[model samples]
Target: MYVYDEYDQRIIEDRVKQYRDQTRRYLAGELSEEEFRPLRLQNGLYVQRYAPMLRVCVPYGLMSSRQLRKMAHIARQYDKGYAHISTRQNVQFNWPALEEVPDILAELAEVQMHAIQTSGNCIRNVTTDQFAGVAPDEVIDPRPWCEIVRQWATFHPEFAYLPRKFKIAINGAQSDRAAIEVHDIGLEPVQNAAGELGFRVLVGGGLGRTPIVGAFINEYLPWQHLLTYLEAILRVYNRYGRRDNKYKARIKILVKALTPAVFAEKVNAEWAHLKDGPSTLTVDEVHRVADHFVDPAYQALQDQSALLAEQQAEHPGFARWMARNVNGHKKPGYAAVTLSLKATGYAPGDITDKQLDAVAELADRFSFGEVRSSHEQNLILADVEQTQLLALWNELRELGFATPNIGLLTDIICCPGGDFCSLANAKSIPVAEAIQRRFDDLDYLFDLGDIDLNISGCMNACGHHHVGHIGILGVDKKGEEFYQVSLGGSASRDASLGQILGPSFAQDDMPDVISKIINVFVEQRHADERFIDTFRRIGMAPFKERVYAANH
Candidate 1:
């Protein structure tokens, strides 16, 4: 993980002090709710349905054991004793008192963390693959670039108040685990024919009331031109993005109205002047950032673990856990393990303070004192030794974090819908819970095989419903809650938005609808084909036909 430099430290401390003063003024009636709104939002505080929620950034989803422990402390002392991991790989506390948020941020500052840019109509947290440095297929680690962008975007005067919230994601692996296609800006590091490093830049992609995959803006931007090229994109958005209507303010809308080609042309015209500016990244600065993320010191060991193999043979539950939770690591004897938060009857990404502390301790004991939050809202210890797998599992089991459903049906991705979010047309968490209850059998989930069931409260797609194999979107029909279904959406390298099935269903009918869709996939799929592959091969007609047959 990258350590904060003096500049980084100074800026965060200043921001914290600024927010603390702003908070005091708001409490003293010097600032009204409307006046304090933007200030609080800039600090990542949101007034929710029941209470205020604070989202803390976990830069590029990397946290030290020490940082994790601090977060656990914050959760315990300031807010409710639990935190929800968001789809953007940030941790959100749902019960923070509005008055105590400044104090919480001050504490976070001590650990080189904060909630800045986690919300508001500005550039939000920059996300990348959680397995950045460790992935086998990576051409180069993307964390350095992510950090660079983080610094540039933080409190950027030009982009501080954009037309709407903008998100940027970077991916370095062959797989699109970061969901680059659905971000305002997506950067994929690519090597040219001559083996020089660069990025494939995509723009105008987003998921919301309107979902659009990003279009290719630049095929290859050299390493040195990253900042310049990014500035160009933001400049274009800031100048022409709609300001009249909140609903039409996103850059995606501008891109759609103008067409991607004209959008690129506008950005190119802006880049003509700023291409060689001082902010452009240089080799030395790149090295300075990259050096912070060098691999942890790894001990040499045998290629395979005899004890693990023996244990797997003895215990089926442990065997199943190892199959789903453990990932291949670049190191010989180490594995990356996911501590699933999707246990039955619980919210998908909710982890209590005690569980967070336990995970921090476990990371220090078995891994390299590092923890990662996945985009799927799971916790990962990236360097656990093969020999320690069973012991770690035991500890995690005690903490209620050892659910072996990483890619299973029960491992759902859901947004904090009507229960918390003011924008939601209906509640999504209850719907997710209902579906999980209907399909609680682990064997059945495993047999279903790598199904992605995502639910969003509305079209904002915070839950990533568009890319789910079975996407569920909440809709409003004459002020009543309803759900619309989509099939075959995927967020991998061959990314595609899902197709709608038909008429929306009432909230009570969601589980049955989902079950019917799954049954059709089970019945229609050829042997050895995944749900996505099956959907692609046969199209959505069969599932759509089956779902609305009675209505038709």
Candidate 2:
């Protein structure tokens, strides 16, 4: 993890002091609620349904064990002893007191962390692949670029107040784990035919009321020109992005209105001026940033064949977990473990203080004192030894974080819906829980295979329901809760927005409806095909026909 320098420290301290003063003025009656709104939001403090929610940024989803422990401490001391891992790979505390947020920011500053840019219409946290440096298929680590962009975008004067929130994601791996295609700006680190480092830039992709996959703006932008290119893109968006209506204010709207070609043309025109600007990255600076993300020292160990065979023989659950939750790592003996938060009864991304501490301890003990937060809202121990797999699973199981449901039907991605979010039409957590309960069988879920079940309380797509293989959107029908289903959505390399199934189903009918959808896929899929592949092959007609056939 990158250590904060004096400049970084000073900036956060100053921001904290400023927010503290702002809070005091609001409390003293000098600032009205309306007047104080943007000030608090800029600091990542939100007045939620019952209390204030503080979203703390975990830069590029990387955190030290000590930082994770501090987060656990914060959850214990201030909030409800738990934090919700957001879809953007940030940690959100739902019960932080509004007055104490500045204090919280100060504490976060101590750990080189802050809530800055976690919210507001400005550029938000820059996300990259969770397994950025460690992924086997990576051409270049994306964290350095993510960090560079993070600093550049933070409190940027030109874009401090955009018409809507801007998100940028970078992916360096062969697999698009960062969901780059759905971001306002997406960068995929690539190597040219000559083997030079560069990025494949994509723009105008976003998910919300109007979901659109980003289109390629540049096939190859040399790594040195990253910041310049980014500035150019932002300049175009700032100038022309919609401001009259919040719903259409995002860069995606602008991209849609202008088309990618015109958008790219405008960006290129802007870039001509910025091509050699101060913000243009230098080779030395890139290496300096990249140094912080270098692979940790690992012991020289061969593959643990005996240990794997033992795990397969002794523990079926561990075997299943290894199959679903473990990812290939760059190192020989190391594996990236996804500690699934989607247990049968728990909220999708909720982790208690105890669980957080356990994860921190596990990272320190088994991994390299580093942890990652996946965009799927799961905690990752990125460098665990294969020999310790069963033991790790046991510890995680005791803490309710060992669900063997990654990428399965039961592995649901959900938002803080009506239960906590004021914008939600219905509670999404309960819906996720209901569905999980309906599909608790491990064998059955494995049979269903690589299904992405995502739910959003509203059209904001906070839960990324638009890209789930089975997307569920909560709707209000005649003042009653209902769910609208979509199929064929995926957030991988072959990104595609889901198409909605027919009429919405009532809350009570949701579980059966989901089951029917799954059954249709199972009935129609070719041998060994995943839900997404099957849906793409057959389209939504088969699933839609089966799901709504009885009603029609």
Q: Quantify all predictions' global Cα lDDT against the true fold.
A: 0.89, 0.90
Q: In candidate 2, residue 478 scores what lDDT?
A: 86
Candidate with top TM-score is 2
RMSD of 1: 1.4
lDDT of 1 by residue, 355-389 (tens): 88888888889878999998898999988888888
Span of 10 residues, lowest total lDDT, candidate 2: 303-312
Off by over 4 Å in 2: none
* Number of clashing pairs per prediction, in order: 0, 0
Tens-place lDDT digits, model 2, residues 227-334: 999999999999998889999999999998999999999999999999988988888998888888777888897888677978788888888998999988888888
Candidate 2 overall lDDT versus native: 0.90
Best-fitting candidate, scored by lDDT: 2
